[model samples]
Target chain A: MIILEDVHYTYDGIYTALQGISLQVDDGERLAVIGANGAGKTTMIKHMNGLLRPQEGRVILDGQDTKFMSVAEIAREVGLVFQNPDHQLFLDSVKKEVEFGLRNIGFTENEAEQRRQKTLASLGLEGLAERSPFTLSGGERKRVALASVLSTEPRFLALDEPTIGQDAHQKNRLAQMLAEMNKRGRTVVVVTHDIEFVIENFPRTVAMAEGQIIADGSTNMVLSNDEVIERCSLAPPQMTLAARAIRNVFPEVGQRLTLLSELEETIMGILGGA
Target chain B: MALIEFADFSFKYLGADSLALKRIKLIIDEGEYVVLTGPSGCGKTTFCRAINALVPQFHRGYVAGNVYTDGKNTRENEVATFASVAGLVFQNPENQLVTLDVEKEIAFGPENLGVAPAEIRRRVEELIELLDLEELREKHPHEMSGGEQQRVAIAATLALKPKVLVADEPTSNLDPKSAETILEIFAHLNKRGMAVVLVEHRLDLVARDASRIILMNKGRIVADGNPREILAMDLCEEIGVGVPKATQVYKRLRTRGVDLRNVPLTGVELAELVQEATSQ
Candidate 1:
């Protein structure tokens, strides 16, 4: 479990990035943190892996205080993938990049190689194993960065903008991979601007604005709230908007429909009744 | 003549074994808003680079056939010479922004083109107002948010008064709202008669706004047509282009025997169509 108690962080002693943020993530929880740029979503996620220690509060990771742990120490349990893949990827070969994380965390050479190969194949990066990370396309590089982090097999995985450069197909594959990771008892926390991905994948969501948590609950509930959606600069899923628009004709239809299947069922029901 | 034309174009990066873009023959006329889309590594970025002659001129790639911008063959002219004909906005705003502040960044293009100092100032001011970057005029572009920096980059690109603006996934780094804002700017610019060629994956947001949709995959132009017609195709979904959610819903409803006419691109349009279909 990860717990943040009234965490406050200020950058350069002036810009308050996080303001008294309090949250908790149970083991195996899938949580998404969303907001506009400069909303401090990244800052809050950095606390999970001790990348940024709160100035005024405490972050507890599995009953241990994160303040006492170095980034390398906390990384054993919590792996963080930065928003910019270039920031974390410095190795030559894609295979070596994944192995580096495993080796650094004290994994034996043979064990690291095993995990590295498995991680690469899982992310569909086996073909690019021998290629340089720098030469890959943006989406490919993102997966390489992810493979590097996933190779370590951390208990908690925090991804910052994992869906940014990915297309629908890559995004679908990533969603499936994250689900598999979560099922294996890894807690997943994602900070992203991709609301559609959030609605389709994550169950719980936290909406932030101006360095504070404005709303936190089920993804459907939080995304349906007009105030939160507007304040966070989030574009609601298209189906939700369409459901709301046709509410007068089919008042029983739920406006929180985020998936095509849900909307299809509602429309079919309405057509049958009509 | 077309604003941009590619004739049997195929290109391979200097050391790459296979072609990045294969036999892409297309014409983009003036004032057209074309949204190029496909899965990652589908050569959408390469297509955008070809418009501005970056593929062969700057990247030093093996090129076959011709790309003409503003009726001038790209192979014949310098990359700098095409700056005024086709402006390319890169994916990452940080890379394109060279000046310390927004005002200078906007002015850099016109200045490099040897435009008069007075004319450059006028263009900068006009672009600042046009892109709603007035508040950020004096601020450093690197210090601003991704959206703000992109706006500056677009403004700088516009300062050159290019006939067509080619943005390579300009909104990839932006939040949804900011992404919408950037697309809106492109739409607005297109309305003012400047051709806009945008490479994007978020087809749901742009399908309604674009005049034409070009879908690419495996270095080939798989589909190209009106947004409504192209997005309604199964190939769009099969090839990994994100068909608009509303369109997806419409298709699902159609599969279930819901009779609907005309593919809807937006939520409001879809709602109206459903209402019309069920009312009868």
Candidate 2:
């Protein structure tokens, strides 16, 4: 489990990135952090892995205070995938990139090699193991970056904008992959601007705006709140909007209806059949 | 003549195993808004590059057929010659921004084309206001957000005053509101008689505004037609293209015998359809 108590951070001693944030994440939890650009979503997640230590409060990872732990030490339990894959990928081949993190964390050569092979195969990247990471497409490189971090088998996996530049098929695959990882006892945290993806996959959401956590609750409740959605500059998922638009006609249709299947079922219920 | 034409065009990279674009035959006329989309690596980018002769000219590829811009064959013309005819905005705004600040970046294109200083200044000011980049005029491109940089990139491309604006996934990196703002700008530009050909995957945001939808897969134009007609087909779903959420619901309702008068492209439209159906 991870807990942040009244955390505060600033850049260059001028611009405040996080202002008194307090949150907690349990083991095997699936959470999403969402807001507009410059909302400090990235800065908030940077605290999870000790990339940016809080200036005023404390972050507790498992049982230890993160302020006392080095970034390398905290990284053992927290794997952070940056918004841009290029920042994390520097090795030549995809195989080397995945093994680099494992080797640096003190894993033996044999263990690192076995984990690397399994990670690559799991992400459907075994076919491109020998290819240069720079030569792959944006989506493929993102998978490679994920493979690199998943190979570490960290307790908490925090991803920043994992769905950018991906098509529907790729996004679907990533959702499934993240679900599988969570089932295997890995906690997943995603920071993204893709509202539709959040509504579909994430069960819990934290909405932020201007260096503050505006709202935190179940994904459906937070997204359905007009104030939170407007304050965060987030567009609600299409089905939710559709349900709200006809609320006068079908007052039973809830505002929290986000999934297409949910809306279809409601309409079918009203229509009295297929 | 059409603004751009690809006649039985097929292209292969210098050492690639297969064709990047195969036997593409299409014409994009002036004042038309076209949305080109498909799965990743589906020749959509190559098609955009071919519009400005960047494929065979800049990338050094084997060309099988002909591409013409404003009645000039691309093979016989320089890439620079088509700059004013077909302005292409890349997917990554960071890569295409040449100048430090937003104002200079917008002015760089027309200056290179030898436009008069006064004329360039006029176009730059017009684009800045048009793209709502007034406050960001002095900010560096690298310091701005992804949405702001994309607005600047679009303004820079518009400074050249091309007949057709070809953008490759301009809003992929933007937040939802910013993406809608960018697409609205493209629609506004198209309303003013500048044809816009945008490459994007978020059909939910753009399917309503685009006049035509061109679907590509494996280097081929699999489907192309009116947005409503094309989106109603199962081809989009089979090819992994993101059919709008409202459209998906409409199709499901149709299969279950809830027939609506039209294919709704957006949530509001879908709700209107549902209201009408339930009222009857």
Candidate 3:
């Protein structure tokens, strides 16, 4: 769905945000880009959506270089959700915000409204149709931002920090929502710094630092190793550390569990016949 | 005397019908680490600004009752007086930053107050080393990353040597490692006899570090207690606030009828508790 080959992006022709980046994400794949602040995660997402073009290399969406595509054309192929939802949401009403993009693409009023209803209902935002988008809370802003994107029905959805400022329940809901989106055969890429979210949700993890890709592979391998996770400025999950801290007590239990669910299962197994 | 005291204080922002905070009475002991949190619009940030007299002084609204900071009444004390008493690091580092360069930014607060040049030099040097920002000292704000900028913002505020450090959502935008560094910095400051008031949602991160936890809602403090006691309450999870991983494990075990007394708040604590549980 997305490919980056020696992609180099420099903002204003002087400052390089991404340096010679090479990454490929297949359809229906859930890939997480994990890094600290200014690690080029946002830069990478902007390239994927063709918002920023590489000065040196190429960013290809389905084998087509973004250098030739229009913003409207790229918007159809890839939906980008910004970190701050308020910055993207401009319209007064929630329904109107979702339909804004569709209307821009020259959809009929009836078609746009139909698309809005479907997208909101799918994201469980149906009842909030008439409410003012500005009056919504932070989490609601996040969902509405996503609703606006989902209304366009793009093939690949790239979200930058979908779970920021969210509560525990909202975090889980976002996790489940992303999982469901991936299961529905939509390519999903998330840029996040939360280690727990990366460990539990992403099947494949890509680590970046100082405008470069450092590590990319199965989520378990990328996040389990202390050196890699630490170098990327992420700590091991709490359960992984807890399991490691008390490994001596349970000789049979491994300290390799990354998720809480894995630790719970291991604990139950150690307790015998759960 | 309490560094900050609020007795039945309530406030309504300009153009708002309902009170943002209601009947709020909180006394923060000097040098205490208080973790204030609740839902997104729960008025935790409003309460933090009350210490710096931002609520009634700068922000338009109706403020009721009494608020005292460092023996000075909030209503009467000029915001400038609280300026040295309290330093605020807002959530967005980008939005809070005023200067272009890191060193200049760090020196901004003291400059605003017209502190002596020699003291400013000492403070700038102290905070540079304190926040490990020596490498980025001369870098432009736009040149640095978000985490680095956040550190600069805090370092700038810390240079003022405020008696109270009120950080609003300090780590919400940072990565885990950066967030850890931030919390560690807060802990170090709190240890230096500075009252650190952290308004955040991630109670789990500072579960052990906080001297007390005060959960706010609808402009009112709904729950106030020690970390262990307040986190054990079910209200925390329902409202989207988090407890430590250890507390979460204990809550799960308790739901399954397992009597896990005194669950620790960190991974190390959980390890000891598990050992004790297995041995018995």
Candidate 4:
């Protein structure tokens, strides 16, 4: 479990990224963070892994203060995949890149190799095992970065914009992988601008604006509120918007829908009634 | 004649085994707004690089056919000459930033082409007004957000007064509203008679503004036609290109025996369509 209490952070003591932010995430919870650029989404995620220390408040992990723990020590329990794969990829080959984290966290040579192979295959990166990291495409590089973090098997995984450059197929594959990981008792927290991905996968969402948590609750409620979405500079999923449009005429469809199948069924029912 | 033409073009990297682009044929007329899309590693980037002669000039790839811009062969003309004809904006905003302040960065391209100081100042002011860069005039690229930096990049490329602008995944790093704002800038540019070639995966965002959509797969053109006709086909979803969520809903309703009159691209249109069908 992770707990944050009135956390405040300032870069160079000039720009404040987080302002009195407080939140809690239980073990095995899947959370999604959504906001505009420079809204402190990345800064808050950094505190979870001890990359950035708070200037005023406190961040606790499993009831322990994170101020005394080193980044390397905190990383054993929390793994963060950066938004840009180029910032994290510097190794020669994909195999070495995935194995580096395992070896750093004190895994044996044989065990690290076994886990690396499994993670690579899971992300469909086995074919690029021997290829140079710089030669891969943007989407392939993103998967390799995720595979490296998955090999560590940390209890909490934090990913920044995991669906940025991915297509429909790749996005589906990632959603399934993260769902499986969440089922196995690992917490998954993702920060993204992909509203559709959030509506489909993440049940609990937190929206930030100007360095403060503005809305936090079920994805359906927070995303459907027009005032909250406008104040936060966020555009809801297209399906959700369409559902609202349909409700304008049919008034009977009360709930906010985020899936196309549900929208189809609702429309068919209305047409049949006519 | 088309402003840009690819006649039987094929290219391969210096040491790579297979060709990155194979026997591709395409054209871009004057003032056309075209969107190119496909799966990852499907040669969309390779095709964009061939526009300003970056494939064989900077990347040192082997070329097999002719690429013409304004009736001049890309291989025959100097890369510097084409810099004033075609402006390229890369994926990452940080990679394109070279100057300290936003104003100086916008003037860097025109400075390189030896424009007069007064003319450069005029262009800077014009673009600042057009792109809303006045508030960020003194801010450096490293100090701004991703969206701000991308705006600076676009303004910098526009300072060259290029006739054609080719951007690869410009909105991949931005929020939805910021992405829409950027595409609206492209629409504004297209209205002023500047052709645009955009390589992106989000068809739902750009399909409404684009006159044509070109789909590629494994180094070959799979589909090329009008945006509405291309989007209505089943090949897009089958090949991994995501259609709009509303399009998916419309397609499902059609399969379930709903006779929709027109295909809608935006969510509002889809909603109105459902209301019309039910009210009747």
Per-residue lDDT of candidate 4, residues A129-236 (tens digit)? 887777777878998999999888799999999987787877887898899999999999999988888988999999998899999999888888787678656776
Q: What is the TM-score of chain B in candidate 4?
A: 0.96
Per residue, candidate 4 scores C-alpha lDDT tens digits across B206-228 of 98899899988778999999887
| Per-model TM-score (chain A alone) | 0.95, 0.93, 0.91, 0.96
- Model 1 lDDT per residue over A1-274, tens place: 9999999999999888999999999999999999989999999999888989999999998899987888878888899999889999998888888988888888999999899888888777787788888767787888899989977878999999998778888888889889998999989999988888898889999999999999999998898899998988878778888888888677887646777788788878777887
Give per-residue CA lDDT, model 1, range B1-280, as digits (tens).
8998999999988756578899999999999999999987778878888888787888778889999999888889888989998999987899889989988888888887789999998988888889998789667775699899999999998999999999988998888899999999999999999999988888888988899999999899999999999988989879888888999988887777776878999888988888887778
Q: What share of the true interface contacts does each candidate keep?
A: 0.78, 0.59, 0.54, 0.71
What ranking emerges by TM-score with the best candidate at the front?
1, 4, 2, 3
Off by over 4 Å in 3: A12-14, A90-99, A106-144, A268-274, B15-18
TM-score of each: 0.96, 0.93, 0.90, 0.96
Per-residue lDDT value at A187 in model 2: 98
lDDT for each residue of candidate 3 in B1-280, tens digit (9 for 90 to 100): 8989998899887755568789898899898999987876577767887888998898868888989988898899789898888899987798889988877887888898998988998898888998999899678888877788889999988877889999987887888778888999999989988899998766668888999999876677889999888988999888778677767776777776665558578777777776776666
**2 or 3, which is superior by lDDT?**
2
- lDDT tens digits, residue span B1-280, model 2: 8889999999987655578899999999999999998876678878888899888898777889999988889989999999988888875788788889988998999999899999999998899889999999778786788789889988998898889999988887777888889889999999999999999888999999899999998899999999999999999888888888999999999999888889999988998888777777
Note the residue pairs that clash in candidate 4.
Answer: none
Error of 4 at A127 (Å): 2.2
- The Cα local distance difference test for each model comes to 0.88, 0.87, 0.82, 0.87
lDDT accuracy of residue B81 in candidate 1: 86
Which 10-residue span in candidate 3 chain B carries the lowest summed lDDT? B255-264
DockQ score of the complex predicted as candidate 4: 0.69
Which 10-residue window in model 3 chain A sums to the lowest lDDT? A265-274
